[model samples]
Structures are given as C-alpha cells and as structure tokens.
Target: MERRVGEQYRITSKEIDQYDDQGYLVLKNVLTEKELKSIDPIFDHFVAGNESEKMGKDFCDMSQPYGTPIEDFQLVNAMLPGKYIPSFSKNIFYRIAKNIADQLYSNGKAAMDYEQFLAKKPTKAEAEFSMHQDLGYWPKTKNTWTATFSLALSDADVINGCLYLIPGSNKETELRSHRPKEYGTATNEAVNRDDSHTLIIESKPNDKIIHLPVKRGDVTIHDERIVHGSGGNLSPDWRKTYIIAFRDERTIAEERAIGFTHSHNDEVDWNSIIK
Candidate 1:
C-alpha cells in the first residue's frame, strides 16, 4: 500500500541490514498519488524547458560538456529543486527519505546534503550515465554516512533506462580513479579543466551489474560509495527522477571548507536566459 501525504514509512532492521550488505535498497510505494500530483507539474515545468526566476541553476545536458547545444543533448538535469520550489522540501517523499536516512546513521541523525532532478529523453541512446561512485564527485572527507534517495516520477524499466548498480561495491575502502569522459587518456588534472561535468570509471568485466526497474512513486536509496549509473531511455516515455541526498552535518561542513560546490550552485536569471 502507498503511504499517505503525512504518513511515514517505517524502516525495518532487516532492510537496514540488507542496505548495509548490498549498499542499496528499494522502497516501493513510498509516495501516494496525491503527493505525486503535487510534484509532477513542478518537474514537468523544468522538463518542458521552462525556467523559473527562483531556480538556482538551469537544466543542462549531463551526457555532454557544459555548453553542448540543447538539441544535441540527451540526459538533462537540474540540481537543488528544493531551492526554487519550496514545496519540494515539504513533500512526504522528503520526509520519508529523512526518516530512512536517520535510521541508517550511526548517531541517528542526518542532514540534507543536496538534491537534483534528472530526465532521460525518449529514444536517446547516448543518454546513459556511466558507472561512477558518488564520492568520486565529492571532495575528500572522513564522513561515510551519506546516502542518496532517488524518487521516480515516471515508470522506469530496462526500455526506459532504469538504475544499474554493482552489488557490494561500496565495501571498497578506497575510491577508484575517475576522469572526465571527454579526456580519454588525459591525467586526473583534466577534471580541474571543467570542460565536462560527467566523470566515469571503467567497469570490470567480472562486475555483477543489476538493473532495478520500478514504477512511479518508488524510491531507491544507495550508499554514497556504491558504483551505480543508469542507461539511456529508449522508449517513447520520458524517465524523470528526483534525488535527495543526506549526510552527517560534520561532513557537510568539511566539504564546504574544501571549496566544493554542487554543479547547481550557479544561480541565473531564468527569464533573461530562456526566451
């Protein structure tokens, strides 16, 4: 059964154990129909190429470099929707995510680290997000409690590009090397060049990649260090997703001290930029 707007979804110890072992968990029917209705229009507004004055960042192609033409783009994303749409933070989905995150934390406390909105346009074969760990994009920090909650706004399947993850990859103590997709053989210093936002790691031939397909309202939670990515949307329907991440407050401060900012930190006047 789906949870109501104000109702919370209880997280079981078994689920926590599973998350600890596999580094990911899928909670089905976490959001009710009413809650979906409230947020659908907000996502649609961005997906349709509309911009709001309050939005901190504009949607950009994740598959290509920063200034790639819109028509040539495949997967597009907007970060920190809660910054522009206040209701997004107040939604039941966010509350349930927090509840689950609190349970996963050793100290029983968690704070909002960041959030994002992503969409895979229909039939975009090159829209796939390559395999990489979330910590690969973050600044080096001691915190390891961070987790990301991905809420699907539309049905996701193999045909429409669902999430794929390597089981137990989070067990690795060290982060693998990652580089910008554009710089095929360039040094890690190429990441500082800032030409491309997409960073990827090479997948091993023996890695066990599992595809997770879910209906709208299902939420998938994954550890920050998990090796994960999604395929391109080949079906006619769009695959839209909302992501909220949480971590210990101390880690958040450490990341800030290192001058690390999310890709969505760029605030722009939408009306002026979008005609």
Candidate 2:
C-alpha cells in the first residue's frame, strides 16, 4: 500500500468531492500508448492461442478462459508462484494499489487479487449486461469494503458496446437483481427512470473514465454500491481491459468464496487481476 514514485497518482480534493457525489471518476492518460502497446500484443498472443474458429460463440469456450487466451496463464490463481508476469500488469498492481491505499484509506490496505484483465468482443448473439452494482455478485455488507479499477484497452463506444453507469447510484441503498438462472438467462431489463441517478460513461481510446474506461494504468476507486453495466460489443474489434478489484482485510474471506487470494504477505500478484 506504500506509494511509488513514477507510479503514484494523486487524487485532488475537487476530484474526491466529485467522485463522492457522482459515484465515479475518470483519470485520463494514466497509461501511455507505449505502455498499452507493449501489453496489448502480449495479451493478443494469449487470445490467439485459444482462437476459436467458431466466431459467433456467446462466450469464450473451453478453448479460451475469457474469450481471450491466457497471456500469463499461470497467474490465473494467485496462490501459486508463476512465471508469467506482464510488466504492465505487475506495475499496476504494485504501484496503483499502493497509490490508492496511500491516498484514500488510512489503516486499511487495498488487496488487489480479485482482479482480471477482461476482453469483451461482439458475438452473433451478444446480450446486454443488466444494470447492477459491482458488489451485486458478493454477499451483503453494510460497510464499504471494495471497489474496482476498469481500464479499457480499446475505444469503447455505444456502437461497439460502451460501458453505461448510473452515476451517483452508488450513494443509494443497495438493490439486488435475481441471479442469471442459467446460461442465456433471462434478464428483466428496465429503463433508467432517474436522470439525476444515471450517467453513461462513453469513452474514447486513451480517454479514461473511472469504474469503466481507465488509461492502461489509470485506476478507479469506487464505492461498492456503484451502479454499473455495459452494452454488448458492437464494434468488429474486441474491448479489452485489465480490472483490479480491491478489497479490505475484513472482506477477504467473502472475496475468496469467489476465488481470489494474495500471492505474498499483504501482496497480490499483479497478474492475479480477474473479472
């Protein structure tokens, strides 16, 4: 959780106020093209290994873990020591997590194991993700113990499945949606009725939006109840991102049920980022 120079990003008071009020924040240019360029190809190599000839498949099949092959395949589980560690992924976990811990929470450290580098591509039968909080999948809690850092690897647009969020929705009481009954589960979708509550974060390449589109290294520290979701990818290219989900010590057990653990003493492998 200690800060590192060249990796530390200071959150301003104004930005903090805005994030507290709006439920999200965007940090632009956190990752330069040089950084992204180095990592993208490595990730592409992983995706290529599991390339499925079945182009229209709903999700990555047994061939791919997340519709993209694994770059540092060994890093999938943090408990094991692995040889696959991409520089970008490693720097983000150590530097970004440390910066956030230094700037936001005192006496509390950010555990960055429950994170994933995600790649979402359009399929023949792609479905829109339902509006829900990031914490929707976890057990209920009264305290704020978790947040997410979503870094978009490509230009995310409505035409190609941009991420949509209910701004300030994080401030409201938590609401639960029924679990997807099964694969291709039916979702009771509804319109966003409150303008003040919802705000869509449509992003351009290298233009980061917190909780969604962050520069290669730009991280978003959000409240657990932030209302967030994404539209299906409409673009021909895939939407790639590295997500580092951070949590407090008390919440570690609950997170482990979902399969995330640290790599060392108070340290999570940078490659352990998951969905």
- Candidate that scores best on lDDT: 1
Instruction: Evaluate residue 177 in candidate 1 and report its C-alpha lDDT on the 0 to 100 scale.
Output: 73
Model 2, CA-based lDDT: 0.48
lDDT of each: 0.78, 0.48
Per-residue accuracy of model 1 over 1-275 as CA lDDT, tens digit each: 43334566777788889899989999888887788898888888876666634442356777776666656768978777776667667566677788778877777368888888899999998889888998777666676678899999999988989999998999987777776577343464544325666778999888899999989999999998899998888899899998889989888887666555464443322222211
Per-residue error at 182 for model 1, in Å?
Answer: 1.0
Backbone clash pairs in model 2 (N, Cα, C under 3 Å; residues 3+ apart or in different chains), count: 8
Model 1 vs. true fold: TM: 0.87
Off by over 4 Å in 1: 1-6, 52-58, 183-193, 264-275
